[model samples]
Target chain A: DVKVTQSSRYLVKRTGEKVFLECVQDMDHENMFWYRQDPGLGLRLIYFSYDVKMKEKGDIPEGYSVSREKKERFSLILESASTNQTSMYLCASVGSTDEQYFGPGTRLTVT
Target chain B: EDKVVQSPLSLVVHEGDTVTLNCSYEVTNFRSLLWYKQEKKAPTFLFMLTSSGIEKKSGRLSSILDKKELFSILNITATQTGDSAIYLCAHCNYNQGGKLIFGQGTELSVKP
Candidate 1:
């Protein structure tokens, strides 16, 4: 089975602080994604990396950035955390298709 | 623009009952549709449908996709309390390198 693991299950940060969320996949998938899920908004993509050092902005990439220095690890960075940035963040990995394997989300609370 | 829509935002059903979840999409360079079951934390893969009229089944859950209509349906038979979860539908296109466009999801509640 494909195992996607997130660094933190829950996190709380003060406003104006910087935050990092990490994800690692054992499947060595070529594609990694970061998304924030809200009540009515569903899962909106923040950023995605297709290969090491290659990143693309998704629909809602503002206030968020991602890093893929290695094939197994992907990190999401918040330049300056704000209250509005609080949401459940999910990380996923896929090979050639959309059949992604997801990690347990990190519930971020920016106070 | 590519979009995925799911209907009946929420549903309540009793154990042993049957439920159907709907998903529709309008996307360029359509590739495949995926179904996921999310409990409180993580979303788990359920099914992946690529061809129209082909049904994918696992236990009591089954799903079928209609590419021509740009829609899909997920059916749960003999539903149990454990079956309650948020069912999510996502459409993927290679044009975006498998970036998934997701629907709002259907919140299902099964009472025992």
Candidate 2:
């Protein structure tokens, strides 16, 4: 079985505070992705990493950044948390089977 | 930009009813189309369609792709309360740098 775990299931942050979201995959997948899901807008990609130390921006990556220093770890960083940045964040990893396993998700609230 | 659209945005049905969720896409250099089921938190993979006309089935759930029509449909038969969830459709392009453009998704409600 494939397992993906996120750092937090819920987070509360004050405005202008920096936030960090962590994800770890146990399947040693080569591709990892971060997405934020909002009602009516569905899920939008934030960032993705195909390999260690390499990252690519997704559709809505303006307020977010990512780091992948190891094969199984990916981190999403918010430079400064804003009210608009509050949303449910999801992390996923894909392997040779072309299937992506997703983490439970982190619901962040900016106050 | 690659675009994916799914409709009707939401649906309600009773137990034992069959439902078909639709997805259409306009993608450049299409690699594959994927379907996922989101119950509570993260979405889980359901089907990955590459070839047209061939249907992928897993017990009560099935899906088929149409390359010519640029569309796909996921059918769930004999749905139960447990089958109620949001169905998402996404398209993978060849040059998007591993990006998957997703549809807004169809929220399904199955009543017992």
Candidate 3:
């Protein structure tokens, strides 16, 4: 089975603080994605990486950035956190079969 | 623009009742449609439908895609409380290296 693990399950940060959410997949999938899920917005893509050092902006990439220095790890960075950035962040890695495996989401609360 | 839409954003039914969730998509490079069941954490993969007319079944959950209509339906029969979760539908865009466009998701609540 494909295992996707996040660095944190829950996080709380003050306004203007820098935050980082990490995700790692054991399947060595080349495609990785970051998304923020809201009540009505569903899962809006923030950023995605197809290969190491290759990144693409999704629909809602503002106030968010991603890093893929290695194949197994993908990191989402919030330069300066704000209350509006609070949401459940999910990381996914797509396998060769076109199946996306999601990690345990990180519930971020920006106060 | 490519998008995926789900109907009946939320539903409430009894344990013994049956429910159907709808999903429609308009994607330029449609490769397949995927269904996921999310509880409180990660969304678990349920089914991936690429062919139309043919229904995919797993126990009491079944789903079928209509390529010509650009829609799909997931049906759950003999529902149990444990079957309550958010059902998500996503469109796989082959052009984007299999990037998915997800719907808002249908929240299902099965009460006893």
Candidate 4:
């Protein structure tokens, strides 16, 4: 079985505070992704890393950054979290099969 | 830009009703189409369709892809309350650095 774990299930941060959401996958997949899901907008990609020390911007990468120092771990960084960034953040890893297995998610609330 | 769009943004149905969710895409170098179910948190993988005219089934949930038409449909038959969730459609393109482009998703609400 594939397992993806997030650093926190729920997080609360003040405005302008930096937030770090970590994700670790036991599958050793090459691709890792960060997405934020809103009520009507659905899940929108924030960033993705295909390799260690390499990252790519997704559709909505304006307020988020990602780091992949190792193959099994990926971290999402919110430079300065704001109220608009309050949403459920998800991390996913995809192996050779193209199935992106996702973590439970981190619900971030910026007050 | 590579895009995926799902129709019927929200649907409400009673138990045992059959529902068909539509997904259409216009992407360059399409690799595969994937269906996922999201209840509250993460989107769970449902099906991945690469070839056209082939149906992927899991119990009452099935999906079909049409490469030429650039669309796909996910059908849920004999639905139960457990089937109520947000259904997502995403497309993978070779040129997108293996990233999957996702649609807005269809919100399904099943009532007894």
Candidate 5:
């Protein structure tokens, strides 16, 4: 079974504070993705990395960045947490068969 | 621009009711379509459709794709409270670098 784990299930941060969200996949998939889900907007892509030291911007990459130093781990960084950044963050890794498996998700709240 | 669109952004139904969710795409180099169910946290994979006119079924859930029409539909029968969730639709393209373009999703609420 493919297992994807997130660094935290919930996080609270003050405004202007930096936040790091980590994701680790045990399946050794090469492609990892970060997405932020809102109430009505659904899931909007934040960033994705296809390989170590390589990254691509997604639809909503503003105020967010990602790092992939290792194949199994991907990290999403929020430069400065804002109230609008309070949302559920999801990480996903693509399988060999083109199927994408997701982690449990991190709910971040910026106060 | 490649896009995936889903109808009925929100739906509320009583127990034992049947529901159908729609997804349409105008994606360039479309490879496959996928459906996922999200209750509170992560979205769980439900189905992936590649061919036209082939129906994939699992328990009370089933889905079919139509390549000719560039659309797909997921059907749920005898829905219970457990069936309530946000159903997401996404399309994968050949040149997207493994990124899946997703729709806004349909929020289904099943009342007991």
Candidate 6:
């Protein structure tokens, strides 16, 4: 089984603070993604990395960035946390056309 | 732009009842359609449908995709309280790095 692990299950940050969400996958999948899920909005992609040091912006990338320094780890960075940035963040990994395996998710709350 | 839509937004059924969830999509360079079951945390893989008219099944859950009609249906028989979850449908496009375009999802609640 593929296992995806997120660094934190829940987090709370003050406004204007910097936040980091980490993810690691044991499957060594070539593609990793970060998504924010909201009620009525579904899961919207924030950023994705196809290979080490290669990143692409997804539909909603503003105020968010990602890092893929290694094949097994991906990190999402919040430049300046705000109330609007509070959301359920999910990390996923996939190899080829197979289904994506997702981490347990991190529920971030910005105050 | 690629898009996936699912309906009805939510449903409630009693145990032992059967329920059907619907998903429709409009995408370029379509590759495959996938189903996922999400509880409170992560979404778990359910089925992946690449061909039309063929049904994929696991236990009481089954799904079929119709490429020509650009839609799919997921059916659950003998529903149990454990079957209550958000069912998500995603369309994959290889040209888009196999990026999955997901529907809003159908929330199913089974009462015992």
Give all TM-scores, in the order shown: 0.98, 0.97, 0.99, 0.97, 0.97, 0.98
Model 1 reaches what TM-score against the true structure? 0.98
Query: How much lDDT does candidate 1 score?
Result: 0.94
Report the number of the highest-TM-score candidate.
3
lDDT tens string, model 6, A1-111?
899999999999999999999999998799999999998778899999999999999999999999999999999999999999999999999986659999999999999
Q: Is the docking of candidate 2 incorrect, acceptable, medium or high quality?
A: medium
Candidates' RMSD to native: 0.9, 1.1, 0.6, 1.0, 1.0, 0.7
| Cα lDDT listed for each candidate | 0.94, 0.93, 0.95, 0.92, 0.93, 0.94
1 against 6, candidate with superior TM-score = 6
The better candidate by DockQ, 2 or 3, is 3
What is the lDDT, from 0 to 100, of the residue A24 in candidate 5?
99
Which pairs of residues collide in model 5?
none
Tell me the DockQ of each model, to 2 decimals: 0.84, 0.68, 0.78, 0.73, 0.72, 0.74
Candidate 2 structure quality by residue, lDDT tens digits, A7-110: 99999999999999999999988899999999999889999999999998888899999999999999999999999999999999987755678999999999
Candidate 2's C-alpha runs over 4 A off are B96-98
DockQ ranking, best first: 1, 3, 6, 4, 5, 2
The DockQ-derived docking category for candidate 6 is medium
Comparing 1 with 5 on TM-score, the higher-scoring candidate is 1
Model 6, residue A87: distance off in Å is 0.6
Chain B TM-score for all candidates, comma-separated: 0.98, 0.97, 0.98, 0.97, 0.98, 0.98
lDDT (Cα, tens digit) per residue for candidate 2, span B72-101: 999999999999999999888776544688
Q: What would the per-residue lDDT of candidate 4 be over residues B1-112, giving only the tens digit for each residue? A: 9889999999999999999999999999989999999987788999999999999999999999999889999999998999999999999887765588889999999999
Candidate 6 segments exceeding 4 Å error: none
Give per-residue CA lDDT, model 3, range B1-112, as digits (tens).
9999998999999999999999999989889999999999989999999999999999999999999999999999999999999999999898898688999999999999
Q: Which stretch of 10 consecutive residues in model 2 chain B shows the poorest summed lDDT? A: B92-101
lDDT of 1 by residue, A1-111 (tens): 899999999999999998999999998799999999999788999999999999999999999988999999999999999999999999999986578889999999999
Candidate 4 TM-score, true structure as reference: 0.97
